[model samples]
Target: YADALRVAQEAAEALPIEKDAIVGANFLLGLAQIEAHTGQSKEVVKTLRQLLTIPAGEYVSLTRLKIDPVWDPIRNDPGFQKLLSEPEPETVYR
Candidate 1:
């Protein structure tokens, strides 16, 4: 878990913010998984928040967070629970 966390962190950092949004989301998902597995609830929730900022995609979703066993460790975290309960933000386009 420690190794996985380290690698995920590194990969996430190495990703270019503009060009790799989707890939970065995937790395965030991996980091969240590692953090949850290693009892780092705070870090896991933080990572999930980061993932949530990415546009709707294939990596993480409120539904997955609610149901996936991988996120069970942080499921009860206030931050995580708040994320689940909050209404989806309104997206506006010009």
Candidate 2:
């Protein structure tokens, strides 16, 4: 778990911001999932929060967050629970 976490973190950091936001966001999401699986509640919350700030973050599926088993460890955490409860933003199609 530790090694996987380190690799994910490194990948996220190594990814060029000018390339693709989605790729970076996905890496961050993978890091957060590993954190959650390893019982790093604080780190999971922090990573997920950071992910929310990225432009590609909007593309994250709230449904996946709610049902994914990888997030089970943090499922009961207040911050994680709050994130789950928050309503998804409505998309405005032009």
Candidate 3:
């Protein structure tokens, strides 16, 4: 679980800016799905919340939540859904 979180963290770092990696959204979704399957929802939420902080998250996160069976626990949580829809900080590359 910890390792998975670490991997997810690393994946998030690779795409801090939208222009850098078009695949960022897919990577975050995959990582969140994996975490949701094997760990506590708290951990899943924690990792995913961190991952979902990527640029232009809305549908990338929501669509993942909607489709992933592993995230069922959080699928209905308002906070979880909000993370998908809320405005994230605009990411900029130096």
What are the clashing pairs of model 3?
Answer: none
Which portions of model 2 show Cα errors greater than 4 Å?
A: 16-18, 53-59, 89-94
- lDDT tens readout by residue for model 3, 7-44: 87688667743545446766666666666656455655
- Write candidate 1's Cα lDDT for 1-94 as tens digits: 7788899889878883355866766776777788888888878877776666667346677877888888887778787888889765442221
TM-scores, all models, native as reference: 0.79, 0.73, 0.46
TM-score of 2: 0.73
What shift in Å separates residue 71 of candidate 3 from its native position after superposition? Answer: 1.9
Candidate 1 TM-score, C-alpha based: 0.79
TM-score of 3: 0.46
The lDDT of model 1 is 0.74
**lDDT at position 48, candidate 1:** 72
Candidate 1 vs candidate 3: which has greater TM-score? Answer: 1
Error of 3 at 79 (Å): 1.9
lDDT, candidates in the order shown: 0.74, 0.74, 0.61
lDDT (Cα) of model 3: 0.61
